[model samples]
Target: MSAMYGHRAKRFPKLPEHRRDQQIPDAFRTTMAGEYFMLGQSASRHILVLATSSNIRLMATRRTWALDGTFKIVPQWYQQLFTIHAFAAGKLLPLVYCLCTDKDIGTYGFKSQALIIRAAALEVDLNPDTNICDFETALIPAIQGYFPNARAVHRIAGELGLKTRYRQHEETRRKIRMLLATAFLPVPHVNTGVSLLEAGTTGTLAALFQYFRQEWMTDERLPLWNVHNIRTNNHLEGWHNRLNRKAGKSHNGLYELLQLLIAEQGVMDTLIQQVLSGNAAVGDLRRVNKVYAQKQRQVARYTGEYTNVRRTLKQFLEALIRVRAAMYGHRAKRFPRLSEHRHDLVLADQFKTTKSGEDFLLCQSNCRHILVFATGTNIRLLAACRTWGMDGTFKIVPQWYQQLFTIHAFVAGKLVPAVYCLCTGKDIGTYGYIFQALIDKAAVLEVDLNPDTIICDFETALIPAIRGYFPNTRVQGCYFHFCQAVHRKVGELGLKTRYRQHEETRRKIRMLLATAFLPVPHVNTGVSLLEAGTTGTLAALFQYFRQEWMTDERLPLWNVHSVNIRTNNHLEGWHNRLNRKAGKCHNGFYEQFHILIAEQGVMDTLIQQVLSGNVTVGDLRRVNRVYAQKQRRVAQYTGEYTNGRRTLEQFLAALMYLTPEPI
Candidate 1:
């Protein structure tokens, strides 16, 4: 008996053994009324769309559409059963069903194209004013690509897990409802309403507002979700529930599901006929009437027809605040003034430790907050590295500090920040104190912090302080800063216009800066070549360069020949990243400290990954195409000079040609 039942089941229409098969039996390719149902299938058989002629005609007349996908009711060969529904005789009815092999943008694109092509063949316009769907990131762009004129409304509030939160807390429920009310606002006032609500929120509610801003308030999605009369795709969900109940089981056989869909189409045809002939009622009007009445009341309130005058966005927000106060009583202040003065504030215990609970705060005193943020492993890496980069950023420093000074070490080919100091002064005394603190901390950790080369800018006070602290260390000035100094001198001598318009003047000035790239012995000769026939602003520029940069004590500081890493650009880029993370200039002391702590946490993870051989750090900096080409030319010229093919004068001219504008 079991064998006979198996044979009978096999005789029934079955799905293809492989999903790659695109052929469909003729008997199952049409609806019960003999209307073609299998509209189209993709060439790869990854997507198949089905719709009858009458349903397509009905879909063409509707102005709104709701799309959704169901998984449980699909056959084993398919991933999901996707559906598109439209209003027919005042009821939402599924007009199209698609069997997709995958849930990606490409599959949806195929489905959209099939419908468009079929509609064009039947000469039925498929333009919709509004399309409703869930927040599937892949589906939104696919729908927009095929119907650019349609406004795609995403059901955000339903899917964000807000319903459970709303029912739990009264005050939170009121705030969440107010957030939903933003949908009813005029498109121009939506952002205003959100900002007003955001200002009044704090703690977890503030985080919720941030998420909303990031996900829904973007320019492309803002207009898509902000409709005056917002509608949801809840009706489509109900239709899926009905289809599941009719099927009686999950993962129904392909033939059985097709039969059920044909019967559904037949029922829809009869209902459509009944409503057209005036023999049956269209739909449940009570629920729709209630919705419309609520929308009208909201519109009347906004226009002041129900009261006195049109209300502003502020007035609407104030009304919500007043209602909340009436129901829940007055709330406390969101952000109270800090009790301690900005200069008196101290780091909390939590901020004193690294994310791994290691001691991170090396010293905190009245003069400076010297933070040596290296773990034991990081200290070892620092001791082993031969080069270091040091710089400070004043813009991101706390108001109580003069600058955020950072020390970076080259580790495994990547320049990683090793120490941070918040100093109250940019003087020799403050810098000396910072270095002393670092030395003391290194002594305690049993690691010596000595580097062979230190790269920095030509800060008048910083250079002298660095030399005094690390007398044996080699100090190399940034090559980019050298060019900037020469350009500034040119401007000071009132040669800005001549430098830009006169090619000879510009080349002479550039050659003066390009001497930094020459071999140490030849740099003076290169400068002397540029010194001949100099007068007026050009002579003054040369004198300034000699007095400031070429003195017996200053020559080696700026000359970068044979130096592997010339500029502190990697450190500068790190500072830029910190500025972006700080989000504003001169944040509060604790706020900036928190940002630093987060940065240390990231460094900790990276250190572990590096030690474990999971990550390989690349070049310290990335050079653009133009600068790379210039470097190639410089290399070629240097090679010629090394082989005695080119004279010193030719090398200087080639280097000058490659000099870029001050960066």
Candidate 2:
């Protein structure tokens, strides 16, 4: 009879017969004190704020707030168990419990019940200085609408975790990881780096670009991930995790959930006392404060490497972090996994478009090799040329390898980079791999790519491979590289800067080294002159030059009188342009890939322009216009009488007047 009497009598039906929003009667609205215990609510929505006491409301009014949710403690009918934690005295105290009907913008009672007005009644500021929350799509709109003036600090860890598992391929997957790694970087730098990373992504990987822009790259979301601030809602997350364990795994009823909150109120009161006494606090609050102090000092002491033309952003960051770590006698932390960085090498088939949407990545043939061309026509022009120029740049290659080498050839009289190769090392085997790939590619296209002459620096490892494969081809050395090598020997011999000042000795030493560029008969004559020359520094430099360059009649290999060009200036120019396009020496793989694709477009444009008769002799000649003009004039004088007809005075005064004015 007593148990039956405790149940409510249902003689009349309530407002909605099937309404899920069970009403809380006036009997449960207040505590022992006459002051209002539950926060104000309306019948239009199911809003019952638990533990909204004067003391808790007062503490919440003057402090920051973190709103979080847990599913484990929620009733079977409810969507989630929402908690609003007040950050006071460096601890997050659970001040309110909001049993939400559903996880949606409409389900929240902020608008329907006038949540801000009710909070104002308890002296609680609805809009605090900062409000930290998870990156929940539903929560974001509600918070933005309610707290327009408050700074929204969305936790970025959740987004970063989602991004780590974003793409399928390793290349794109790596880039997605880098997005989070770059969060600590300065804003402008992040903007630029993000754009570059975006350009490198395609196919399945490209989806992350939109994801980043939507979830993390928004203006409101950008500043939250700065290195100095709290980028994750660890405090709220930790509380939810503890609450979940406390409630156990099974779903509870509405009455049980309220009872759970009643128990939480006791714990909250205990935590409030601890916070006031400056005892134990949230782990995030303690650790972030402790680490930030040391981080600021370390960051200040270790002057970081600023990003520059020579150093890539990633390289600079790595060095900066390493320097900081070294100051503390620790290993540097590696941030951002190099993502789409290896796209060109690892996932070679994906990057297939250009800025103008052309077939930029010409071949996805082999993983061991990258045979890049500006266009299909570059192959044809390369095949037509009898001589090929080759050079490698160590600084401009991807960090994974030794050098970015290119094979150049004169196409329509303008020397252009024909084949770009990413070499693993500057060895005979590497060069053999490159040449064999080219030969195989040519066979597939039914085009003859065998060159009559191959010009390059004295890379011994490469020289043998070229000769062994293209046995009949003439191998020539660059005069500029040869001269640079001779100069290097002079430095090693300790001649000092004064070596060039001593004109007589300098000319004599040069004449001896110049023997390599002379005829077979004259080679011995020059060496003999050197042996008969004076016996000081000149003798030492000349003897070394002779033993190295003059031995075994090697003079014939460097004698440019037989080849069309002497210097590897075209090869050097190609490398310089490529380095600039790539933006750094040790560029990321994706960066190098983008550069290679762009280089293809540049070559194709030049080739098309030259073949169309748009490029004149003046354009082909990088020297002064007067030189090209003089060459053209000389061509017109093919039928001129004996050379004696043009006297020295006529050549000097008449030609000097024809020097074109500088534009």
Candidate 3:
């Protein structure tokens, strides 16, 4: 039966040998319902477009259109299989399919012209309000040339190639995301947003901005890519994926591909008929994801406010942070078995010691399970290091624990994880107990562990606990966390909108954060300068800052001027690495324990290599060029202030100028 079926399938006529010899057969020139399926071909016979009459008529009614080309599913003779989709009744329908031998401007121009002539013959107007596509130099101009009144909106397809670079550099990722957010800015403020982004970039980012300026900043193309109200071309790209799946393979013969397209059209026709008859609902084929819906709401709100002159470009950019936060802030659901696995005896024994049989489990209780994976070498390094970095990650913790807390020591010019603790809660009692465990273990090992400074985030309970356990140690807050706190306070005080629209307001708010860079003695003077002439939200902001950060004891914790390493970003990076290794949020207890044990072994080997001078660990934290430049400017300002060349107010103003807007 299989052999006979194969023989029957091969009985069809041979396909064309080349583009020049290609000809549509009479049987394939019309739809199954007898409407013209081969709508038109280019004069050079190099481009052929297929669309039934109903497809053209439906496309003419749509105000928005999307165009894209895919090469993977194209036959070997053609350059690509280009598609034009129409958004009708909330469904993105592929209305026209074109096969082209070239991807040049002439080829696209011919395709556009053919569509226009075909639509004219059917006495239907084919004018779209917006056209979405990738940043194809040839296709963009072709669309603009034929449809001068239509707005061209470019998709984010151009930036997909930079995904790896984005993952490696957080600052670069933030800047690139902000660039995409420029599309949501008001038409008049789009250039201003781009300019602000360009001013803060350097190195590779400078080259990226240069490309953006040259290709997308021109008068003719500026409006083409700014699509604040329109949807992206993701749905159109999805349709192409479906087509590839239906065809089963790439480079199908001419007849085979046509048959697939015809079948797709038949399905679409049935859907259209059902929708028109009220038997089916007419909307997006797939439900919008929650994150995407929230982002759309935010954009809509921001744009609505812009029209009323109540919102500014800076606010829109700030709102992008909220949008991004929404994407990553979702809490993972807990699994009952995963949480209970912490009490399993076999798993407990498995995780109680290092692979070499050293004591890795420091404490295991009903309320908490504190696992210290550091070997004795790590403990010695910890005792020798004066400045320790501490942080915690909640995403990858087992369901039974609240956070996977870590303590890192600066070893051989690199921050190395010295301890890992899985805590059941974030209260002061839990933190004090964990610190006590470390102290008692150090006593047993005869390693005196004393640190001059400990850098951590502003976790209220953890800070006091650290100070309580080590009376002489100074707990310095991360500078990044300090800025984040001030930004959050700005939102709390209802000053976010003002900060976004008013430059003076924004500068004053930034000056509050810049106080971190000032010497301890001069910080009060800087805050006094910012406090002058303040009323309303600004007054409240400075008041909150003074109470929370400028007290006699609290002042020293956040003042990072004399601190060489001002942020715990390295510790945060390590936690991220651990999260990736765990592979999923809220992993099984034994699985997380296994991952940590393996990491401890790796750390032991790394420590030995470092001590023997066989390996050197470079800075794990990525140095952001813009931030480094800002630091240099701060240093210059501080020196001038110390030399009496600038007044306190002058120094604060200069530092404020160097402060970056919260992303």
Full-model lDDT for every candidate? 0.74, 0.60, 0.76
TM-score on alpha carbons, each prediction: 0.49, 0.44, 0.50
Considering every candidate listed, which one attains the maximal lDDT? Answer: 3
Could you report the Cα RMSD, in angstroms, for every candidate shown?
20.4, 31.4, 25.0
In order, how many clashes per candidate?
Answer: 0, 5, 1
* Full-model lDDT, candidate 2: 0.60
The model with the greater lDDT, 1 or 3, is 3
Badly placed stretches (over 4 Å) of model 2 are 1-345, 348-350, 353-375, 609-663
lDDT of 1 by residue, 247-274 (tens): 8666777777777787887777765555
**Model 1 residue 350 CA deviation in Å:** 0.9
Which should have the higher lDDT, number 1 or number 2? 1
Residue-wise C-alpha lDDT for candidate 3, range 138-159, written one tens digit per residue: 9888988999888888765465
Candidate 3's displacement at residue 178, Å, is 49
